[model samples]
Target chain A: MSTRGQLLLLWTTPVAGVLFLAAYLMFPGFSPPMSPTMTPEEVAAFLQANLTATRGVVIFVNLIGASLVPFFACIAVQMLRVGNSSPVFAYSYIICVGIGLTAFILADYCWGVAAYRPDRDPQLVSLLNDMAWFFFIAPAGLVVVQNLCLAGSIYLDARPKPVFPRWVAHFNVATAVLMIPGAFAILHKAGPLAWDGSLSFSLRLATFAVYVAVMFFVLLRVVQQPVESEGVLL
Target chain B: MAITTADAEPLPDTNGNTTAPGLVPGEASMWFFILGDLLIFGVYFVCYMVYRGEHAGLFLQSQRHLDQGIGMSNTVVLLTSSLFVALGTEAARAGKAARATRLVGIAFACGAVFPILKLVEWLPKLGAGITPGENLFFMFYYLMTGLHLVHVLLGLVILGFVLRSLRSASTPNMKFIETGGIYWHMVDLLWLLLFALFYLIR
Candidate 1:
């Protein structure tokens, strides 16, 4: 194998394993602790009452997640490569993901613990909450990160030798701009900008949906012939 | 087969910043795509994190149920696969075509094993009657790690391609290996996280 190939493999292998392990180990009921409001006895009763279908959606999600991760990742890797701005954006994307992953996982375990042990220290509980707040739940910083990547992709594609199309560029910009409110909407609370982040979460997400649909359409259009190798798409 | 865009003459020295000039256009574009993907993953992650925040005890209480041994074994599988990928790249660069082919084959094999082992690990659990929405923690667990599994399958497919290319005397290109390797590294990194998330926390 070439050194470049070696380097690529080094980065990807662990991620692949994690993907696999995550699928299996992080199953439904692996981290059970749902009824924060009810006492343990009451919680058991509640679970007994609503036993059949409660975790069904989550299992459905697992089936879906098991499928989507690889497919999306491939597209993502290829899309970034469709043009040539790897050096500028690679580390940022990975690091940000690294941060997000850490946050997600930490919050995951902490949530499990807190759920199981209701009598745990309030401070510890709060600290865990804070961790999730900073790391997992809020979509604010990440929304920008996505846009930045999209913008970078467009900016690169907008190059003289354009590997992608001009419409794709326009589409990326529109998506980036439209996604701004989503970050705040994710929290469903008064963020720094206030005002309920402009109403419903669905609306915020809907704006992004437009971006996703358009971007995918544009990507399909651009991929028909990605011939220009010499220049950045931007 | 015939002269394509690559056969086009190298442009005159224009940009002076060709430091690691080996980085190909294909490689660079992949990075861009990966970065974008990260954002999507980040959003999902953010969702997981936010919910986790409100219910820390609920989350960790269940985290202790994890089986650390299997998690660690998967990590080993990933790390070993990475090493094989690296060695495979080296073999190709050295022009030892057969060596390169074998190493890539091993890497691919390693990749395959991880997912299979994953299945082996999960089968019993599904049978055990545990489920997501069993609690708040389970929800995120299924969401985060489930996403990761999909990536693993994809990696396995890609690795299979790399190995096939090797047999054809196409001898995996340095750029392909590097790109794939970097991606492999990302998979490995995610596992360390799983360990921390599921096992370490408890």
Candidate 2:
């Protein structure tokens, strides 16, 4: 297998395995946040009221997740580089990914997951918690693994023997770095848009503004075919 | 010598010449592409599970409202249709164009039955005003199954075109056959996932 084939296989295999045994694995570290029910105005009022170390950490971790998307975007070309898919397949690939793109554009994970209240109906909350657990097993796992694999694949491909072009490697590196801020943003949300404390409103908007800007650049790149060498697609 | 082509295979437009080392095409990455799609939808699937687990009661409540038989029937329809496409691929590869075309026609008909069945399944939900983004159940139902349905429709369209092409074209290339087969398999694969995720989520 080519390096990427191996990388993708490795990248994808764990996700598949985990989803298969999803019910078995215990999701560690990333606990669900409180489920608050504050209104938008209340959320704005709360953001103005607090700044602390723990709050910063939450924002930072969430930032890491939300910002990780560009790396996924970087993979778009590299994955395509690995082979010539049928036009329909290619079209579907992009469309399916386009759906995934909603996460970044909406930034709901940080805004909703992190900022919500913990004290809702015990029954309903427990149900939401279980559902969240299910999510961590597959979609969340794949997102992390896929991003890491794309980064690794790009790096490995950058090595002289790799089939992908050098630019993809550089793109991967840049993408990994670029993804951090948005990830932090995603990690900072609440079930209630009103209550969770993460970043200043200005920073949130600025973070999202930067995210949207970067996302546009990445989206443009994903749509354009990368320039390739004799045996490599950049 | 004037290249009066009684033997030159028509460029996939019509079938005339048959004296050949079969104008076969190369391998396709359709499987790879489908795997890629699986990965993409795989995320959504996980998301559904996560959310479902968190809100199991709601989802189960919503699921209870669905007709399991309808979902199961659609699954059977797609699987059998997929088999027909495979048969078509085999016959086409063997240079039995007529048999391949017939199989493709059957496959197309099978593929056609799906959205019809889905339409029937969806009517009750539509009447109930259930839709994606409304709640966890509708969200996964429409997002996952709706997206799958779109792919099915697209597959049927492709299958129809290929069937038509098969009937009209005299000479067929194995490459086209292979690629078309790959496309059909993707359609089939998506349905399998839909069946697993949409119907069996409970």
Candidate 3:
């Protein structure tokens, strides 16, 4: 593949990230996430109040996973250069991306169902909303495993000139560790472990954003260098 | 990868005492991990303190339920384990692979006691229906300690690798041994902070 083409794929990550955040902000109750403790009637009312914008956000949110595919593929492209004799890590990276993207797609559809009929029973709508947020935040394990695979591949790269810097591997592990608090979101309704809480929501989001930025910049360096003799397999 | 002379060479300090030249005592990459891990945990500590300040009474009440005895016991266990690791690293440096292997084996044995004690501390409370959902304090307690436990478990695995290298390699990877020691010590240090915050703080 042309380096120019790979760079284009790399750019999709930030584009998708920014668009997702924009869609999130377009929805009224999501910036400060809707509290898990919010009553069913309150959740239903909030959805009813912003019904049209909610649908718009849902549509954009659903498209995010598709837009992010190119970026993930690009990551795997770089993983191909990690010098492991077997291409298992690159394959593992793609598998993880599929799982992670499926989670977001499922989460988006939950929101869509919640807004499908604003006049639906408040309890059901609230349940779907709960499902949406749970699907959104609680699947930190997916990202954790994904990054660990990437980090492991980089760490095991025997080449003196590794595709990704050694510190990036450490950074990836640290990012994975930070995401773990989100796994416990299922156990709390309030405080820092809830879907709406600081450690689970804010910290994870920040870490993820920073992770994307770091990966983007590093991948940029990868694509800019003259194509090595060991070309990308894909 | 073999240890480089730059990492193995001894140098004199300002006081003229010769010391190992690897000032950071491991791969620089491992130090990066240690610092990043510390920063992440530091954030959690700050968050815990803020929440504790908001609900001092509830936190105080919840904290009293924690078993100080087990907490202190685990602290001693980890400290002893860390001491062995330090001695093990020194022995590895002095070219005593067999002795180093023994010391690290002892460290692993001591480190293994930590999870057992954690289960002992946790099982009764869980049986009594206390869980992360009981209150914010318990939530932080379980979450932080659980995270720390993972570190301990991972440290044990690293120590295992260190032992394997010591036993099998013709020239032991001193840098690898030192890196494992650094990680084990960090695990020990985090547990001490956890013990103080969860058990001793009033």
Taking all chains together, each candidate's TM-score versus the true structure is 0.41, 0.41, 0.52
Best by TM-score: 3
**C-alpha-based local distance difference test score of model 2:** 0.54
lDDT of candidate 2 over B52-155, digit per residue (tens): 88988988888887788988888888889889999998887787889999998888888889889989988878888777656877867877787888888878
- Can you give the lDDT of residue A19 in candidate 2? 38
lDDT of 1 by residue, B122-180 (tens): 67766676567577777667666777788888887777767666677454465665677
Model 3's A-chain: what TM-score?
A: 0.94
RMSD of 2: 17.8
Q: In model 3, what is the error at residue B67, expressed in angstroms?
A: 74
Off by over 4 Å in 2: A1-234, B1-32
The complex in candidate 1 yields a DockQ of 0.02
Q: DockQ each candidate and list the results.
A: 0.02, 0.02, 0.01
User: In every candidate, how many clashes are there?
Assistant: 81, 51, 0
* Pairs of colliding residues, candidate 3: none
lDDT of 3 at A71: 73
Superposed on all Cα atoms, the candidates' RMSDs to the truth, in angstroms, are 20.1, 17.8, 15.7
lDDT of 1 by residue, A1-234 (tens): 112322343344345445534543443322332312334455444434443433443343334333323323323443444455444454455555555455545544554444444345555554543443333344435545755765576567634666456566566566556556544533444533322234223344456445544544454444444343423221
Query: By TM-score, how accurate is candidate 3?
Result: 0.52
